[model samples]
Target: MDNQTKQTVSQIPLLTTKAGPRDGDKWIERMKEEYTSLIKYVEINKKSDNDWFNIESNQMGTRWQGKCWYIYNFKKYEFDFEFDMPITYPETAPEIAIPELENKTEKMYRGGKICLTVHFKPLWARNVPHFGIAHALALGLAPWLAAEVPHLVENNMIKDK
Candidate 1:
């Protein structure tokens, strides 16, 4: 990631609670933290004119879907993205996908599940409860788009608008 990205991600607070959907009130506490972190992250991006995504979760905060974009050569390449939180949650990072790009790149698996960098699993494991959906977007999807979007555009795998 670039320095700007690192700085941006650092601005978002980390999750402190270790809770999953089955944890009841503890899960609610974790959701509060997740929303707090996500709100702050969105505010930061909007303030910088660098906002790249717009997402909304289910009432349970277990499923999310929205649009995300990358700008390359002044062209905006946008794609729809979605993910579901695993039962293991904070211990298991969510897998995000841009289904529109499913067959367009080798960097993704079937159904457009972006292949996170090798560092992601280890870092997420180490962070445990501290890494939430916001962090996953910052550290996983953001970088994947940064690295792949241009290639997709260049190869005509996707269009820019």
Candidate 2:
């Protein structure tokens, strides 16, 4: 194998062992490449450290707000909670959890594993192989955050109204 190909192969095990599914090797490589580019973009743009958002694991699957934002209860009809994203990227969907809510759980589906539709679906679809991790995360997370913020939605609507 060529040196580049050998290097790629060597990296696969490390990613797969942590995430799972050999199919994710390609996705992981793409993420690594994209992350490098994103880092460069941030640096070139001279982005402020505060501009970057932080999301912890444990709150991966569901939608939540800032460190102490609200979440959708769906049960008590309350959607006020804070959540974080999962650790695994591209390969596995994040696991969203509500630390304040008892018996609260965020999963992809009923008895399903954590899998972000925007992240994993496009990656697996044969017709769409051009999507990358950073792009997917940006698209999905942005909408999710907007949805969780009623004031933001209300402000936008009022401006339109």
Q: TM-score per candidate, in order?
A: 0.95, 0.34
Residue-level lDDT of model 1, residues 13-91, one tens digit each, is: 9999999888989999999999999999899989998899999999988899999988999888888999988999989
Can you write out model 2's per-residue Cα lDDT over 1-161, one digit (the tens) per residue? 24632333233212122332233565355445544544443343233332233332222222324332323222111222243333444344433333333222232334322234654355334312333333333333333433433543344421111
- Against the reference, the lDDT scores of all candidates come to 0.90, 0.34
Best by lDDT: 1
The CA lDDT at 30 in model 1 is: 95
Please report how far candidate 2 places residue 79 from its true position, in Å.
13
Worst 10 residues of 2 by lDDT: 12-21
lDDT of 1 at 38: 93
TM-score computed on alpha carbons, candidate 1: 0.95
lDDT assessment of candidate 2: 0.34
